[model samples]
Each structure stands twice: as C-alpha cells, then as structure tokens.
Target: MFGKILIANRGEIVCRVIRTARKLGVRTVAVYSDADVRALHVEMADEAVHIGPSPVGESYLRGDRIIAAALATSAQAIHPGYGFLSENPDFVDQVTAAGLVFIGPSAASIRAMGLKDAAKRLMEKAGVPVVPGYHGEAQEIVLLASKAREVGYPVLIKARAGGGGKGMRRVDHPDDFSEALSGARREAKAAFGDDRVLVEKYVDKPRHIEVQVFGDNFGNAVHLYERDCSAQRRHQKVIEEVPAPGMTPALRKAMTEAAVKAAKAINYSGAGTIEFIADASGGLKPDRFWFMEMNTRLQVEHPVTEMVTGVDLVEWQLRVASGEKLPKTQGEIALAGHAFEARIYAEDAAKGFLPATGMLHHLQFPDAPPQGAAMRIETGVRAGDAISPFYDPMIAKLVVHAKDRTTALGALHDALARTEVAGSTVNMAFLAALAADADFAAGDVDTGLIGRHQDALVAVAAPSDEAIAAAALAATDAGAPGRAADPWSSLAGYAHFHTLARRTRLRFGEENILARVSARPDGRFQVALEAPHDAINSHDLRNLLRTARWPGHVTVFEGAVGYTFAVPDPLAKADEAAAATGSLRAPMPGLVKLVRAAAGDAVIKGQPLLILEAMKMEHTIAAPHDGVIAEIATEGAQVSDGTVLVRFEDGQG
Candidate 1:
C-alpha cells in the first residue's frame, strides 16, 4: 500500500475510506468544499484541502482541483469514494495522465459499463442475460414512444448515463407516455447531462438483487455473495440485506456465476457491484433475473456484505489497487449469518418523503456488540452537524447481524426503535414499520412494495399522553429550582401556603394545547393536558421518554418517532392576522423547475401547477381547489421550506 492517498469524495464514503486507510498505515488526505470545511471526514483525515464552493459542480466534481490536491500532498493514489467522480471515465483518464494511480476500475472498464444501453449490448454479446428493452440511439420522441409500445405497457424509461433512481420513469399507459418522456428527458439532462434514455419491460413483482464482485490486476475475480435491495421507495433502496431470503443453493450458484462472468468480461478491478432486476412472480429462478446496470464503485449498502463474509472490503480494494491478486478465491468466501441495513434519512415520511434540512441537535445510535461489534453505525454528521440541501439527506445507516434472517430482522427493528434524533424530521418510524411488515418478514419484497403499502406504513400515530407529558415537562422548566429529586424543586407548588399550579402552552402539530403541571410532595410531578384526547395522570415521566431541549424547541422520541414542539416565547407578540386561503407553499427547499400557470389562469383542483426540484427529486405542486391564479413564484428560483410558491385569486370566479 502507498504511504499516502487522497479521498476524492465527501460525507460517509470519505469517512469510510479514512477508517480503512488508517488501519493500513496509510496517511489519508481529504478534500472539502465551503459547506464541508467542518465535516467529520476532514477532521478525521491526516491532511485536508479546500476544494471549492458548496454546490457539487463547483466543488466535489472538480476533478482538476482534486488531482492537484493529491499531487501537492505527495499522495501516491486517489480513491474516488463512490459518488461524484467515481464513475466518470474522463476523470479516471485524467488521474492516470497525472501520474497517479486511480484506486478503482480502469477507464476502459468504466466506459464499457458507463452507459446502460451500451453495457446491455456488451452483456448480451458476452452471453449474459439482459432485460428486453430498446437500447437504441434514436432520441426522437416518436421513435422512443414506438419503442415503449414494442416493449409493452408499464415500461421503465431509464437514463442511459446515470443510476441512483435519477432520470428514471415508469409508464403504465400509452397516453401518459409523451408527458413522461419529456419529464424524464428534462430530469435526465439536469442530473446526468444526457437526455438519451432506454426503454425496458417493467417486470411484475420485480426484485432487485445485486452481487458484490471484486477483481485485481492478475485477471482473478471473486464473488462475496449478493444483497437483496428490493425494499425501495421512489426507486431508491431503503433497506438491504445479504443472502437474499428464499435463495436456494442452485439459484445462488447461477446468479453468482453470472455475476463473476460479467465482471471478468469487463476486466473489472477493485470494488464493483452488478445489479440485476429479477422477476419474482414465480419466485427467484436462474432465467428470471436480467442485468440492470453496473455500479462501477463502492455502494452505499456495502456494510451488510462485510458482516456475513468476515472480510473487510475496503482492505481488499486497497490490496487489489496495489497490484495484488484476489485475496479470497470463489470457494474461500462463505456466507455465515444474515445481515440487514436500514438507511436513516433526514426526511419526513408523512409529507411524501420530502427531504428535510436542520441542525442535528442530538444524535445517538445503539451500542455495538460487546465482543465482535456486530451492530454498525456508519455516519458522517455528528450531534451538532447540519443536514444541508447541497447533498444527500441520508443521516446514517443502521446495520445489524444475527444467526438467522428472522433474528436479524428483529434486531434491525429493535435498533431502529432505540435510535434517537432531534432538530430534523426523519423516517425511522417508517423503517421500523417496514422491518416489522409481514411481507418483509416473510421475504416478500418488490420494487413497488412501498408504493403498495405506503398508506399503512406512513400512517403516524398521534403522540401519546405520556409523550405529551414529557414534552410539556421538558418544554417548561418543570425542575427549574433544582433537580426533580431535590426537596426545593416543589417550591413552585407552594404559593401562599397552598398548592399552586402553572399552565403552559405547547404546539404539537398544527394546534396548540394548554397543559397544567403541578409539583408533588414526593419530588415528582403531575401533568394534565387540555386537548381533544383524553387526559391521563402523569407518573414519573422522566423515566418514560428521552428528550432533547433547545432554546425554542423540545423533541421527544418514542415509538421510533420524534415529536418536536415549538415552545412559544412568553414575551413575543403573536401574529397580527392569519393568511388568506388559496395559498400553496413549497413543501421543502428546492428550485422551482417550471411554473405551469401564469397570473389569471383558471385551473381545477389537482391540475398541474408548478414543479419543484428538491433533494434531486421533482415534486409537482397542484391546485388545491378550482381557482384563478393570482401570483406565482418565478421559475428557476430557489425557495425554502414553506415559501409561498403560488397564490390563487381571492374567490373562484
């Protein structure tokens, strides 16, 4: 291994690479943008270099700046840790031309697998099974629509140049094909700078299974098994696991052998993943699976693979990049136990999973195992870090392992329940529900599973009386005089030699509730909430919930959901007047992609209004009711959460 190397990425992947580089006695250099000057990876690296501004195009994607930083630091190689420049073949060539080793596949291999259409063609030539689709170069809308027809209804239109669920659309009918094609083209162009796309047959009950394949300079490759990534929302993987449920020895043999074949065909090197889309209508079979695309670098769900194989994949990457042969042969790698990974993102499941941004006032993970540390928490932001809009809003990944699939699923559920976060909305409760879902427990997974069960999964329960009591206690300085155990803590209750009580107001969701609290003589407290729900007597609320309090907010975590409340200021003035009706607000911070209406245009309820692109996803703002347009936000404008995007006329005229 080299003495030093630079990680050409940011966030969790960069931090992940640093951990392994340290173990190999490799001094690592980290590159950061203005927004990440204080990122965790920068602090953990041996040396750090400032790249550029916050936006990716200005910072992380600047290959020249990254290469200069590496050369200046006297680094021997550059590790493109999976996002920005990892799959860019031109960047690989540039790095090689700069007299530095690119710690990944060669430019030739990346080009071979870069474009989905081209790669599918190559796979077909190599005798690998590929999905039936239109991988043609014709970009005309008329031609593409005909291809979609040929492929059948419910076809999947995917951008040939990129992955990660971006630039992808599913058309279920011919009438919607035109609109879907335009939208997919625009999104693809914005995301990948490529408007070209491919149409594929959408499999019924499709399951996403990808194999982890590694190769080295000596033309040797090995398979570390496969991961089931079918648990998805918006075409993104939410949960991943190894030794896919319901996998038979014969089927595993067929898939793994095919994966190895794909890797060798490309002369792949270092870490890579071969993703396949399988038709599970008749359960997993050798021929039911077809090639999806190849991820030419490390994946976000790689930890689950590491847990079962007892191999450090990063160490292997280093060894292979340093011109070493494959560490373990095909037979040496053996699956031991089951593992699960739940991606914890900073987003609201209730509001259609829109990305959220806020400070992480408090963050905590479950304790690792006492011996082998089976439970792993991979995170880049700490308690005080902020989840900004410039990057992916994933907070961390919760991984767990056990002797069996059932036990591992249970462990994952328990871990999610114990996880705590504050100052930002999250999807932990949704993840817990998914882990406990009957279908998931029985290994019945598919690409559309979330969409089918979203209503039940995203249904959030009202905060319990105990949770409200805890929030009330934390919102108000109930133990202001002293700790609850202190004798003088109850002095607020004894005014004029009589028991006294004070009322406090707290905001739960959209309504404010008045809660009455009184100190007990036994150094405890009693809370009574005045709301629509029945009231319950408080009893030792301190031991019932975990809370984190800020200046104007109190977050109470229970049942895997965080109930955050706004503690009104005593002296602050209230709003003078409520806003008028017929207003549509931006659900989250995003750029206004297009405004579908101008002032005075009449529209019916649920009509197309505006499209806001946030967190790399486009959300169409629709008219709430039949009304005439009054004012609308300008297109290409960046709006924040709750910013009024469009306003309707005073009355439906």
Candidate 2:
C-alpha cells in the first residue's frame, strides 16, 4: 500500500477516503478551495493544501493545481473521490504524467466509457445488450428530430457527456422535440462543455439496476452484486438498495456476468459501476435489461454494496492501485443481508427540492444499530458547518442492513425518524414519508415513484397544537426573570384565589395558535389547547421541545420534522407594503440564465418567463396568468432570493 495519498476531492467522499486510508496506516492529504478552508474534510486530513478559489473552474476542476498539491505533499498516489475530477479522463492522464499513481481506472477506460453515444456503440460490439438509440454523430436539429420520430414518441435526448441528470430531457411528442433538443444541448454545453447528444427509446416502467464491478491491473475482474436505484427524483437516485427486490438468482447471475464483461472489455482497473435500465414492465429478466452507462469511479451509494458484501471497496481500490491481484473471485463474494441507503440532502422537499444554504445549528443521527444490526451514517458536515451554494447540498447518506428487504426497509423508516437536523431546509420528512409509503415498502418502485406520489411525499402538515405550545415554551428564554425568578408572574390567568394565566401566540407556517398557560402548584405550568380545548401539562410540552434559537428565529423538531418560527418583533411594521405592482419575484438566489419573455410581450398562464440557474440546476419561472410583460430581469443577471425578476401589466391589453 502507498504510504501517503492525496484525496483530490472534497465533502463526504474526501472524508470517506481519509477514513480508509487511516485504517491502512496511509498518510492522507486533502485539497480545498477558498470556500472550504474550514471544511470538515480538511480538518480530518493528515495534511491540507489550498488549491484555488471556490469556483470549480478555478479550484476543484484545475488538474494542474491538484497535481502540484499532491507532489508538494509527497503523496504517492491521488484518490479522485467521486465527483469533480474523478471521471475526467484528461485529469487521469495528467496525474499519470506527473508520475503519481491515480487510484482509479486508467485514462483509456474512462475515455472508453465517458461519452454515452460512443460507450453504447462499444457495448453493442462487445456483445453487451444496449438500448436501441441513435448514437450517431450527426448534430443537425432536423436530423435529430427525424431520428426521434424513428425511435418512436417519448424518446429521451441525453447529452453524450452528462451525468447526475444534467443535460437530459424526455420529449413525448414530435412537436416538443425541437425545443427539448435545444434545451438539452444548451444545458449539456454549460454542464459538460459538450453539445453532442444521443436519442434513445424511453422504456416503459424502467427500473435502474447497476452492478458494482472491480478490476485489477493484472486483468482480473469480479462483480459485487447489484443495487436497485429506482427511487429517483429529477432522474437522480434518492435511495439505493442492494439485492434488488424481487430479483431472481438467474437474472442476477446474467446481469453480473454482463457487468464483469463490460469491465474486462475496457481493461477496467479499480472500482466502477455498470448501470442498466431494466424493463420492469414484465418484471426483471436476463434479456430485458440494457446498458445505460458506467460510472468510472466509486459510487455515492457504495456503502450498501459494502454492507451486503462485507468488503471495504476503498480498501480494495487502494490494494488494486498498488498492483495487487483481485481481492476475491466472483464466486468468493457472497451476498449477506439486504441493505438500503437514503441520501439525505439539504433541500426543501416541498419546494421542488430546491437547494438550500444555511448554518447547521443542530444535527444528530440515530445511535448505532444493535450489536448485530448494520447501520452507518456517512457525512462530512457537522452541526455548526455551513451548507454553501458552491457544492452539492448533500447532508449525508443513511445506510441500514437487516435480514430481509422488508425488515431492512422498516429499519430505514425508523432511522429516518430518529435523524434530526435544524437551521436549514432538509428532506428528512420526505424521506420518512417515503419509507412509510406502502408501495415503497412493498418494493413497487421505479424512476417515476417520487413523481407519482409527490403530493403525499411533499405535503407539509401544520404543526399540531401540542407542537406549537412546545415551540412557544422553547422560544421563551428559560433564564427570563418572569419564568425563572417568579413563575406566578409568567402565568396566563389570575384571579382572587386562582392561579395566574397567560396566553402566548405563536405562528407555524401560516397558522397561528394561542397557548394558554397557568402556574401549577407543583412548579410545572398547565397548557390549554385553543382549538381542541384540551388541558396538557407544560412539563410534557417542555420535554418535547428540542430547539435551538438563532438570531430572530427558533427551530423546533417535532413529529420527525423541523419547524422554524420567527420571533415577531413588536417594533417592526406588521403591514409591509406588497410587492410593487405585478412584480414576480425570484424564488431563490441564482443567476438569470435566460430571459424568455421580453418587455411588453403578451404571455399566457404557465408560459416560460425566464430560467434561473442555481446550485447547478436550472429552474424556469412561468407566468402566473395571462398578462403582458411590462419588464423583465436582464439576461445573465445575478439575483438574490425574492428579487423581482419581472413585472406584468395588471391585465392583458
């Protein structure tokens, strides 16, 4: 094994690599950008180096800077963890040219699988089944449209160089093909710097199943089973599981063989994943699956595979990169228990899963599962860390293992419920709801599961009366003189011979609650619910309050959800003027990528008005109703959250 290695990445994956390197007694170096000076991964590394500014182009994407940092730190090899430079073929060549071992596949392997169109063609020649699509190089709009028609309606236009759902679109009709192609090309160019695309037939009821494959420079390769990544949102996997539900032994064998074949065909080295889009319409079958793409590095959901196979994939990567033979043959690896990994992200699940930025005031995960239960939480951010907009908003990956799929899923639900977070919008509630979903529990999942059940999954419930009372009590300072020095003075009611009583008003979302409290003889206060008119002990309410106050807001976690309440200031004006006439505000902070409607242009309801790109995703703002656009935000403008982007006439004229 190498004595020291440089992790050429950031966030959880960097920390993940550091953990394994430490176990192997390998010294590790971490590279960071301007925005990550205080990042968790930096603190965990044996040595740290500053690369460049926060913008990826100037920092993480700069292969030269990363190589210099590794050479300066005397790192024997460089581990490109997952994103950033992990899949960049040119970076691999650069690292090799620098005389440092790249702890991953060779440049040839990456190039062989980098472009989707070319990779598909390669797979077909290698006798691996590939989706029926036009992988040709013709980029003319008319030709592409004709190909889509040939492939039948509902064709998928995917950027040849795209991943993470970027630069991809689904067109269900011929009329929408032109627009979809243009948008896909633009996004592809912006994201991958490649405008080339491929048209593919969209499978009905598609299920994403990918096999974990590993290879050594000695020409040996093996498969570590498969992961079902069908639970997706916006074409990105949200939850991944090993030993796919309803998977038959025969089918598993065939898929694994095909995956191993694909890896060997490329002379693949280290860890890689061969993703397949299986036709679930007729259930999983050996002949019903087609190659999608190969992730040429360790995957974000590798933990589940590790849990089921009882292998440390990173350790294997290190061993293989050190010129060791394959750790185990295909027959040596055996599937153990079922496992599930839920990606916890710092985003508002109810608001289109919009990426959020804030300081993490409080964070906690469920305690380790019982001695025999396998549970893991992988994260790079702590309670006080900030979720910046410069990187992916992923908070952590929650993994659990059990005897069977049902039991493992049950464990997943409990784990999500026990997870706690505050000071930022999160998808915890949505995850919990998903775990409890009957269809999900029964293993009836696909890429469209989230969209099919979005209403229930994203629905936000109002805080209960008890929850509101708890928030109110938490917001009130425990050190206040009224409550600490004289409990009676804090009461909400008082009479000649009765306890004093006080009513406190609190707001949760758009609903307000009046909590009546009175001092009791036992030093505890009694709370009365207004709507339900139920009397409850204040001690009970206080016990349920898990809160943290920051500046002008208090966040309380209750019923597996975190609710933030703003402490109203009496000095502030209540009736602030509404937004200036017909103004449409930007929903979040982002760069105005495109202005679709010009000033004085008439638009109908739901018409695309402008596109705002934030956190590496594009969001289109649409007209609320029929109206003439009076003004529009300039293209390429940087707008803050809630900044008016456009104004419309009072009525169409």
Candidate number with greatest TM-score: 1
Q: Per-residue alpha-carbon lDDT of model 2 for 237-303, expressed as tens digits?
A: 8999989988988889899999999999999999999999998898888889999999999999999
Off by over 4 Å in 2: 370-372, 478-504, 514-516, 528-535, 539-545, 571-581, 649-653
Candidate 2 global CA lDDT score:
0.86
Model 1 residue pairs with clashes: none
What stretches of model 1 exceed 4 Å from their correct place?
A: 369-373, 479-482, 531-537, 540-544, 575-580, 651-653
Residue 190 miss distance in model 2 (angstroms) = 1.3
Q: For model 1, how many clashes?
A: 0
* TM-score, per-candidate, Cα-based: 0.97, 0.94
RMSD in Å for model 1: 1.9
Give the Cα lDDT of each candidate: 0.88, 0.86
> lDDT tens digits, residues 1-653, model 1?
78999999999988898999999999999999999999999999999999999999999999999999999999999999887899999999999999999999999999999999999999998888999999988889899989889889899999999888888999999999989888888788888889899999999899999999999998998899999999999888999999898887878888888888999999999999999989899988887899999999999999999999999998998888888888888889899999999999999898889999999988988765423326888989999999988999999999998888888887887788778999899999899888888998999999899999999999878888888888887776774446566766654556676568767788877978888877777766778888564454456453538888976888888857788888888788877765566788888899999888999898898999899998667888988788888999999999988888888877653
133 Cα displacement, candidate 2 (Å): 1.1
Give per-residue lDDT, candidate 1, residue 601: 93
